[model samples]
Target: MYRKKSKAFYERMLKKYPDVMSIPQMSKACDVSSKTGYKLVREGRIDSLKIGRNLFVPKEYLISYLLIRDENNVR
Candidate 1:
């Protein structure tokens, strides 16, 4: 049930973004400052992949974070 919504949401996201995104791209997609995006990673609110000097955010992680925030009513 919810999985279908998640998949559908991800499909829509794919139209606007890549499967894996950099911090800046994630920040832009989430409508937050890049600093906040980095903070989310640091605080473990968001999962990330660190490769050398770069950070990558998988689109699934974005959906998870959004769903959590929605469930908790967090801003």
Candidate 2:
């Protein structure tokens, strides 16, 4: 399914690029709703930075999140 491929692609991109990503992009990459991404940021679950009205999650943070989730089979 699309989720599988998207997740894999994003994982690959995150590992290779190590760049910051917007909330929407992070949501799509993680296959979650933007609201959830925002909640993660707002709740301090996922660390992010604000820049000119946009929130950006660093690739390292995302990768760590994914790796932890994957390890626990939570995502």
Candidate 3:
């Protein structure tokens, strides 16, 4: 299914990329709109670090967010 494929893709990405990711990269990985990603960053709903002109999200934060979201959906 899509969830399994997405999870596998992320696992591959984690092995290939660094612990931090740019907004665009995060958006693509989560299959979310870039605007939503920016909003999440601005609202502090998801943890991010602003490095000069680019915003970075930690891998840990992304994993936690997905896990929490999955749990909420289950409930």
Question: Per-residue lDDT for 15-48 in model 3, tens only?
Answer: 6556788888787777788998898788886899
Q: Estimate each model's TM-score.
A: 0.82, 0.69, 0.71
Compared with the true structure, the alpha-carbon lDDT of candidate 1 equals 0.84
Q: Which stretches of candidate 1 lie over 4 Å from their true place?
A: 1-7, 10-14
All-Cα superposition RMSD per candidate: 4.0, 4.9, 3.9
**In candidate 2, which residue pairs get closer than 3 Å at backbone N, Cα or C atoms, i.e. clash?**
none
- The number of the candidate with the highest TM-score is 1
Number of clashes in model 3?
Answer: 0
Better candidate by TM-score, 2 or 3: 3
> Residue 63 CA error for candidate 3 (Å)?
0.6
* Weakest ten-residue segment in model 1 by summed lDDT: 1-10
Give lDDT tens digits, candidate 1, residues 1-75: 233245466458656899899999999998999999999999999999999999999998887887787666677
The segments of candidate 2 whose C-alpha lies over 4 angstroms from its true place after superposition are 1-18
lDDT of 2 by residue, 1-75 (tens): 213234565577666443888998888777789999999889987889999998999887887776666666665
